[model samples]
Target chain A: MSSERGRGGKARNWLRLFSRKSPPTAPAKGKRDATPDAKEARAAREARRAQANAKKASRPAKTMLATPAADGRHRICVIGSSHMVAYKLAADETTIDPRLFVHFQGLAGREFAAIEADADGIFVDYEKLLLSPRHLRPMWDPLTDAIAYDAFDSFVVVGTLRTSHILKAFYEWRTTGHFSRAYIEAGVEMLIKRDPGVNLGQAIHQASGKPVVTLAAPLTAIAVDVGDQAAMDEAYRETKAAIEKGFHARGLTTVFQPDETVLDASSTKEIYARASQTLAGVEHEDEERAHMNAAFGKLVLPDILAAAGAQQAETGAPRLTSA
Target chain B: MKNPYQSLPERAFWRPSVSEVEPTAISDVYRPKFPVDKSMRVVTQGSCFSQHIGRQFVTRGYQWFEAETPFTHFPAQLSRAYNYGVFSFRTGNIYTPRLLLQWLRWACGRDEAPDEAWTNREGSVDPFRPAIEPDGFASDEEMLASRNGMIARMRESLPSIDLFIFTFGLTEAWENKESGVVYPMCPGTAGGTFDPDKHVFRNYTFLECHRDMTEAVEILRSFNPAMKILFTVSPVPLTATATGEHVLTANTRSKSLLRTLAATLSEEHDFVDYFPSFEFIIQPPFKAMFYDGNLRTVTKEGVAFVMSHFFKAHGAADETDGDDAPRRRTVTEAENDDLVCEEVMLEGAAAR
Candidate 1:
């Protein structure tokens, strides 16, 4: 009897250790029931697992999808200085805008028309169209003509040349005691009031929230009279510094051209020798005169496209339709 | 034409559609709608290379509008550093084509010049002068009236314009929180001042960029009604980024997105076109074109190679039938002249 009592006691002890009433067991089909201590423990475990997963996903990927492999048809609109229009024509393959064939004078308007007609895309030659009596008839008011606001997909500003010119002219005028910072700021403000569409930040904010890309003008080619080599070198350095300053102030991106740098030799003679070989008899005889060439345009286009493409890839934007 | 049933050379092996899938370089596969030609008047702006394009136009006898004469007479070396008339002044930056159009409109007098403040005996009063250079009117009304007159003259000259060249430069910029002024450089760089209260850096997303660019195109078209646009992205890397990302990587990401967006938009819109200047330098087979010292910059020999290919592709082969095109211009003897330097008027204050 005593042995039987000891075995029962051992069995009872085992039950107490293992079972513990199964933590106030509830029906399997219904909600789980647990003591507060047990419930907290369960929640903690789940939270730990989630944290681990989050950590794993946060690491950067080994490779990024930046460039695309295929080529496509495009509808583009250009607005800016003479350089933008001229370069576009020199690099294009279509002749839709035959008017663009003229050299420099009407090039912006012609190119605008050609791209529009050839690609069946819209063209706004702000330099020509905005200034034209036909478009701005009765005058354009940002407060009123909302139709103008709905027309385009993008806006590109060649800020470098224009800003440089403005700055230069402002400085020259300043020297003559006519222009001041107040004048410059007022000019900027006046432009904003004239065309509500002129506010790039707002235009960007309203139009699918896209960002504006600004291009800085290139450094001027160093110019020289046939005889004064020293003066030419000094001029080149000084001008480059000034333009660089202007570009920096404007927050413009620069497409560094080959000629922007000083060549192997410092002698004005050597500089002239090198420059003459490339620019001899060009319409603009001075070396300091910087102009867009087919080669230069071709060289920079791909980089721009690549940069734009990478941004699109990151943001999950759709690729352009292939031509 | 012999036996029809005889073992034909596996016709199934070659399918016309399948053959069309041959691999091609992205640059060679896409063709711009507007062929570069002498009859086309060309305008270029944005970035340093823009000058190169302008020079090429002058060399080829194409009309390069906005070209400053007498100034062009400067030595080539100096000219590269003193480029003017290559871009517009209204927009302070040049990453997008849209800003270019807006500035153009302002310059052409299609829109009213901004109301600028000038400091005189009274201190910071609204000035009554035209915003554009070479002419300053007394009031906004006068400027607008003058702009109307200028627009008429520009319209008469419109027929001569044939091409618009725009080069994309940056993806990073700072915008004024209140005034909405977008600075080309961060406040601390160059001429701008670092005002934490006003300036904010922005690393724009691709979607935002595309929309801005697209709107720019629309605005441009509204004006010309028949203009062609050719877009190019600058290959230069970013000097800095506000995102705190690696500057190099940031540059790659920024440029890649811009390039892709430009390509996509060009494809989607008929009037829009894109050039492969980015590919001409960045991709392989063309890598040698950059200078040995700095891979970022192009060399004289590299420039020549690029120009050669460009001329060949555009059907503007050099007049000579030699192994290579003859050198167009050499550095001038008087390239270091001091009188020709671009004078900065606001040296101290402008540097703020």
Candidate 2:
């Protein structure tokens, strides 16, 4: 009998492997005449199990369905700095062009410097991206560590160049009349050369031999009394052309922020700037932060895809049509 | 009985001062007449070698005044290539005292700059400083505007300096024969044409150099009366000489004349002092160890040794943070040692 008891004790220990709570036992019969209380406890346990199973059934699997790999659409990889959060949120709410399947890969705060490119493809640290804050991670998981060069037909690089900064350079030069036009132009080139995003985009394009499009960082939402709208507009026009020429010379298509989103040469409309979100998914109303909301991204999406498609067309690739 | 010489210090005797001590360890070479503490705003200008002095002053945490500064937003390489922050102003290699006086005259509005501009397919070049812009200015107006801006900045900055360290570079220069305006280089070598009737080669005599320097100092004093002047003669020999004399003898004559004038000025003026940087490099006892393979460019070690003496005399040697001390090479040695000298173009001009 003692040997049989010892085997029973070992069986109980095996059941306690992942938990400290003892296994439940049948109520001691007739010890306290506790049949009614045992029935109540048994009913409580059954109700808790039912509730958990029901909650599990109601939750959607994987939050949303993954985009099928063989979907009949042109794939475009959208890589960028922290500003890709808007694009991801907008992509969720709005239907992207039916012809394109966009994938997002980004991290906040200059982490793009960690990315590398080679003949195989652009190597993104998938583990690092997954470990980042929720707002900085792509809503959809990247299946592979590296996005192979053949996996995408074209690329859209967001926030590589800040057009607002360039506009400021031009405005200062114009108002003060202190610097020569050539000097201002050279300064703009230096600014372009020094941006981390632009450097990465150049590397990716060179490594992959793929058509690429670069979008300017969002203009500041702060309202400014530029004193003279005409002068600011003139500076904006010249700066835009110079920046475009700079990107074109580097073999990337330049797509500026959509016009309806911005208020002036140096600022975005206050409405678009409202409800801007941080990389950690907090809504920020600060004007100086310079990030844009989902509305701005929604408007900018078509332009980005259009530029990407246009570049693909130039390279004589077959174009996909929306259903 | 002791004679007058018997009571002198060891430094006063040739045996103890020169023969006994090591060449590098030789001290008492300079005793500053006035305190040149870190608080003083110093401006340096002269020939190519003067570049090292200004840079060292800045590196040693001294207040080396820059009259015209480049845009801080740009990378230093781009700004440096455009010849900003290389000197007090963008007067590239003022190799002669006449050129220095000419720049001062323009800055003080005592004389208007000549309208002559050198133009080729590249762009319009400033005849005064032909190689100031890496590529010449886009137009004549652009070039003149830049030149005027420099002069304005110089005019505004001179009155603020606490000390002026000027190095004498060369006695040879080219000038407009009729107007007597001197150019930094012979016109044909850098930009303009070589017309015998228009431009004349001048190896300035000691009297002319002294007179021009005196007027330059007067103009500086007119701006800031309390500004102290310290003079140095560059030990760098000439790249080439236009005169019939051999390059060595020509260089010796040029250096000897400048050195004598430097000594004379220091003795005559209470506010002026001379430093023996020339003797430190060119003296026979040191054996020219400071020169590079070309025997012209000052090596990194040479510049460090020269600056060590300068800092030691001012009692600033102890004040240097190891991060910015002259011994550590933060900037590349090649980049630090190579001076932006337009005079080097004369070598290429000679080859052709």
Using TM-score, give the best candidate's number: 2
- Model 2 agreement with the true structure over B1-352: per-residue lDDT tens digits: 9998999988898778877788889888888998898889998899988888887887776788776665545556555567766777778888888999999999899999987899756788899988887778888988888788888888999999989989999999998988889999998888878899999999999999999989988998999999999999999999999998999999999999999999988998888999888988988767899897689877667777777888899887544432222312245423454578988988886655
Where in model 2 is the C-alpha error above 4 Å?
A: A1-68, A124-144, A222-231, A282-287, A310-323, B318-334
- For model 1, the chain A TM-score is 0.33
Worst 10 residues of 1 chain B by lDDT: B336-345
Number of backbone collisions per candidate: 248, 0
Residues A273-308 of candidate 1 have per-residue lDDT tens digits of 222211111233444344544444444443433322
DockQ, model 1, C-alpha based: 0.01
The estimated TM-scores of all candidates read: 0.40, 0.82
Q: List the DockQ of the predictions in order.
A: 0.01, 0.20
User: What is candidate 2's CAPRI-style docking category based on DockQ?
Assistant: incorrect
The true-structure Cα RMSD of candidate 1 reads: 35.0
lDDT of each: 0.41, 0.73
Q: Write the per-residue lDDT of candidate 1 for residues B190-250, one digit (tens) a residue.
A: 3224678877777777887787777666655655667677787876555445677876788
